[model samples]
Target: MTKKVLVIEDSMTSTKVLQKVIQKAGYTAVCASSLYQAKHLFDQSMPEEFLCAIVDFHLPDAPNGESIDFTIEAYIPTIVVTGREDEQTRSIIINKNIVDYFTKGNSQFYEYLSRLLGRLERNQQIGILVVEDSRAERNATVALLQRHNFITYAASNVADGLAQIGQQNNIKLVITDDDLPDMSGIKMVESLRQQHSKEDLAVIGIAYQGRPGLSASFIKSGANDYLTRPYCHEEFFCRVIQNVEYIENIDAIRRAANTDYLTGLPNRRYFFNRVNAILQSPPAHISLALLDIDYFKKINDSYGHDAGDAVLKGLAELLADICRDYQLARFGGEEFCIFMPLALSEACQQIETLRCRVEKLRIRFEKQILNCTISIGITDIYEGSIDDMLQYADKLLYQAKQQGRNQWISSDTKHRS
Candidate 1:
């Protein structure tokens, strides 16, 4: 489901900018210029429908934080955009149960709002592993994380920590104490580093006072960060937030590297790596196809490169909708590839279906509706290599283009309906 955010600000320029930023971050923004408008919008929509809301401290009608109070009254996770940072204003906003408040004094505050929204969005899927031998300490740590909307798993010892990490997927951050029942925290960090890289998972060690060289030891053992015991709750949250943000940024970079920019599909590098890995233990029944858009250059030459891009994106969406069970990739330009885990006959039928779907796909490109079709070449996996299968599929693809466009050719060079 698409996430919706409510934006209530009186400044037209600021409202437009905030709306643009929110939408660019992949959210639907419902904007209102006044407290009355905000109330009407809130009443019309279910309160639970909004993932979160952003409200200005001063509105035209509600000049004194009334809008913030009203929005919070709706049980929405609210974020305040206040031009004031006075002690009394800060205290009142903090007590209002908002996600967070941002000062609009800085020029980069809007960008920060976008970043905060993204963090809250990702918090739903992020899991933090808390490993502490002291049950009280473990519970306290979990409570703090949970207050910030993080899913937490607790383990009493290093061994249990490792076990929990293995069992829980999407566990991105681990908070561990210096001492553990089964093993030293430093040793556990070292062991964890061997299994998970820093880009995907982060480890922060918490040490007590009088533990000389504890922080250094944890760092040397591959922990990303260390916090001393009896620390402030705000300090602990900041450390955890920074580490999680680092992991998320690195993961995003890795994803971008593995994906095609134009079509939002896996790129050739990912395709080759996955296919090679699969061939190591080749499945009994497998199939692969190399698909290409027919007369793609003509589309670009006649309409524009933008139209070609639209056609490619349209085709990618169609393929994604239909090829849920297959590994699909945009190999470059107008070429795409799909790997099917089915028998020869089934694979052929699936490809024929995809071909018909592509034939019927129409994309509205500035001033005109563009119809596009694709030619596909498919082959069943043999007792040979991935390269061999790809070569066979490419050959069949060539036959498809040679005989006619907008059709598929299997190993038998026969078109299936």
Candidate 2:
């Protein structure tokens, strides 16, 4: 689906440039030349239709940031652009909850605006925690974050802040004040570091001016960065966004390391690591399956590696869907593994279902449809280690391939027909 951006600039030149930037970023732009037009366009569009809004602070019809007010009121993430950059104007725009006001000082500033919009677009997927004892500061910080499309969790004290962080699975950044009612923010940051690593979570400590050594203490206590109170809006966003993006980049690297590039499935190393962990703390019952494409090499020889890749990708999709409730991974090449917490019979049924699906899948490549089949072997986790379970499953898989290819063999086949 194409994302839509709202542009409310009275100047045609700026409007055209901004719209081009938005479209270049693969988004559609809803252009409005005045405050009245912006409201009319917004009224016509759905509440969730606009990804975000770029509003001019001084619209012809509403010169005093009325357009900004309307966008914020409608809960649209907004970035304000204005010709003025005085402290009074900045303060007013900051208090109005604009993501970050931009000055039309130079062409480079607009380029920065485009990048900021891109960051704000991604901010929707990130969650941030604001920890401040003062109600006003907490609210203000949350407002700013929300304006940039961040999901925010607010805490008035250190304990609640930690609890909130623990509860959220996607929160990667935390902004906390140095003075908490119960404990020092430095101590809180130190405590959090014990549970969360810098790669997983980034913290920023906010201290008031004239507080000597506060920034130093916060950093020593494991904060990724520090900010002073009464900070500029631009500085605050820069620090927060940089830290969040750094953590996200680390996460992306980790995912690339653990994922299979061709099929986007977990790689052999990740699959084995998870299985080892499960073995360390055994569950009620664990089932392991090893699957290999029957005559996969023949496909590569007959059609070419490109077609073979298509078959692999198609089979990966089917297996992922079939084993949606279980742990499935592309171990390597035409091989896949499934770790299911199910009874022996149930696991066998699921594996057989997967085999049938593979048999029926017709993958299309360059105007030709190709057919494929997979043979699977299953074993139940009993008193053996993960390696033992894998070796047993692999043995059964060999049995299936030998018993004429495209079938499944379970370790406990004596009971079932």
lDDT of every model, 2 decimals: 0.86, 0.87
lDDT by residue (315-352, candidate 1, tens digit) is 99999899877788998889999998888888888888
Q: Which stretches of candidate 1 lie over 4 Å from their true place?
A: 1-111, 158-160, 381-384, 413-417
lDDT winner: 2
Worst 10-residue lDDT window, candidate 2: 408-417
CA error at residue 202 for candidate 2, angstroms: 1.3
TM-scores across all candidates? 0.78, 0.90
- What is the clash count for each candidate, in the order shown? 0, 0
Error of 1 at 97 (Å): 7.1
Clash pairs, model 2 backbone: none
Off by over 4 Å in 2: 58-65, 83-96, 381-385, 413-417
lDDT of 2 at 13: 93
- Please provide, for model 2 over 1-417, each residue's C-alpha lDDT reduced to its tens digit, 9 standing for 90 to 100: 777889999999989989888888878999999988888888888978888889988887988889998988898888888998889887888788777677887668667776876787788899999999889989988987887789899998899989888788989999999789988889999999999998899999997789868999999999999998889777888898899989989989989999999998888888888778877877788899999999999999998999999999998888877788777889888999999988878898887777777889999999889998888889894666777888998999999888898888888977221
